[model samples]
Target: MSVLVRTEGRETAAGAIRPQAGLSTASRVAAVTVLTSLPVFLPGAANGLICAELGWSPVRMGAVLAVYWLASLSGAFVSRRAALPPVVERTLSIALFATCLGLLTAAVAPAVGLWISSAVGGYAYGYTQPHTNALLMRRCAPRLRAFAFGLKQAAVPTATLLASVAMPMLAGAGGWRLVFAGTAVLCGAGGVFLVRQGMRHGIRPGHSGARHPAATRDRGAPLRVGTFLVALSCAGFFGAMVGNGLGGFLVLALTTRGVSLSAAGAVATAGAALNIAVRLAMGWLVGRVPQVAWAALTGLFLTGAAGTALLTRPGLGAITVGALLAYGGGWGWAGLLHYAIALPYAGQEQRATAYSQMGVSLGAATGPLMCGLLFQLGPDAAWWALTAAGSAAGACVLVARGHVGPRPDAGVSPARRRPRDSPRPA
Candidate 1:
């Protein structure tokens, strides 16, 4: 069963007061996110096999991935005006079903099927992102909210790790088609479970949670797009270029270095594992020390830059160390960033998440394209591009901090409000 917590009107020096979100609810949200994320990253994980069979170059593979991010970018922009489903379960189920369908479609013809399949997957990811954020924002305790976001965002690397580990073995066993088909089956099963839970929870179709038009309007209020928010999102854009580029190309880069596919996948898996651990740790740190959130993000990007520089060095030892640092420190702070962004917004988490997602999508789309273009110049050139992007992202975070630093409580301090008479469902 899911537990919901409504934020009290009162605000503290730390943040708003609310109960912790149920573990089951958070787990479901993460699972749905992982399922939706798979289609976008799977192409990268299985690029070698797919390219070998289809005669496509790395540039063409990058283009395919770009299409997916572009579709997500478009959807994120559109979500600014879209209404979320009444319940989180409905949204998660829809995303899961869409992901399942996309995977199944890609299984039919891994080559031509990728275009449409990836778009569908991207749409599902973009569509569900903000709704899930809003759900966590409304239901999670402010004290632990960063941790919740960390756990949720960890799903992305989890998907990438699963893809990196599973793709090669599955492809080797029965070719790439089997991999997609198997993933689709898993997605469909998850969808079914969510559907059943939604029904059991009394969230039937056409059941509007809002009692009046005014309440609905209030829930979908226009977003406050401030200069500070824009700067922060732009920082995310730059950081994603490095983070996503790292995940998308790590295996291929290692293969070029004369490592076996299985071994390369193992290295990628280690990076992803470290990434997951760091995200959770960062979230916990920021939640305990809210004052350090922005500063921690800035440091993460800088560390990512240093890691990218290491990748430019020769030998598997350098590559392994670089991948761990790059993936762990560089990409681990997304959940904290989201938590920080949503804290000041109070009730507008969905709209806030949409805008942030747009920046990430734009960065994700452009990053791989830039890397692929430079790939022809040699692997070091691609790594250098990522290094530069990571550094720029760190600078952007510093700019954002400057905007927030002068204000009381670092400018994100929630305004105090009158306490409610009693708690209620959010």
Candidate 2:
């Protein structure tokens, strides 16, 4: 039988058998995520090496990271109610190249280099999600959406892991400039590859790219600001605060406790690896039992809160264990959160994702800056603040759940269902 390629998959002419195209799309999404995420994380991961060269303090490190998060807020404006496939394709393509350019700038420029690099990279980071999430909603099957989101989000920790493991070693071997230059080349190549892969799915390049069937169909009604969205944003904000606040300084904090830079990076690497596993597992589980998604998120938040509290202990063993818990549990809900939003919202995925990103970016920006100040007061103070943020995230999830209506099992939005169809999870 002849193969018929759909927007997201390839099916036999009979339509009973599906090919690997869907997996290919999901893989590309994850790849792009890793590339986009890597730059923001590099500053934190290689802070010791970078700071030694620039003579930067923890506060300056925090500022550089915060600027990236703050710049991400621009995504909301760029992606406002944009449902077209061309827009998604173009924005993401530009974001990728921009990310590479920023890295290249950092590699070559002088003392002010990192600041410029952070802003440019931050802009790219901000523009990435609305498009990527839109692509996922269009391509992935409804049944697998949560898992696909999981796989996509897993790239974040994957990036962190790469940064933790590779950046320090690369800097040590060839200087930090070599690290950014190498990364820029990698990102640039990734962008080209993604654009090519997108062609099969009808996501062509340039201002006049071909449209996907999903995006060409009805452009859904604009997403309105409402209580549920507000609660979701709050949850994201608090969650990011806990995650980024501690995570940004994890290596430095470890070093302060007497671990060497290489050893600290190894610790961070282990934590990131654990985080990757947790996010992937949560995504897989939530995809099957979507009804419990919110509860799962709340549990993760509480678990992370406990983990952050563990950071208050003085021993290296305590610090190591705490970092693992904080990384794995505290920071694992993002994919699930985006999946939950995408599942019910369907057509409004881009706008909805963008809305949430704004809150997340602001919190990420605030968290590191606040934690840097707290670290000056003392590391324990910073850790405690992160613990509080995690607890608050759990509370926000509970509030969001309360607002989801009494029939949690009926996961479909009331407005989306037909009158005769029985209500059920999407």
Q: Lowest-lDDT window of 10 residues in candidate 2?
A: 414-423
Q: Could you give candidate 1's per-residue lDDT for residues 1-426 as a string of tens digits?
A: 232222222223333433433445566678778888888888888887888988998778778888888888887788767765555676667777888888888888777788877898898888778778877766556566777888899999998878877987778989887898898998888888877766776444564343422224356456657665787788779888988888777878889989998899788888889999999898778767777777788889888899999998988898889999899877887887776666655555667778788888899998877887788788899898999888988887776666554444563333311112111224
Return the TM-score for each candidate structure. Answer: 0.86, 0.85
Which parts of model 1 are misplaced by more than 4 Å?
1-21, 203-220, 255-264, 314-318, 411-426
lDDT (10s digit) by residue, model 2, range 90-148: 45666778889888988898367678778888878777787677666665555566677
Give stretches of model 2 more than 4 Å off. 1-19, 196-220, 254-266, 314-317, 405-408, 412-426
TM-score of 2: 0.85
Cα displacement (angstroms), candidate 1, residue 308, comes to 1.1
- For all candidates in order, the CA lDDT equals 0.75, 0.72
Clashes of 2: 0
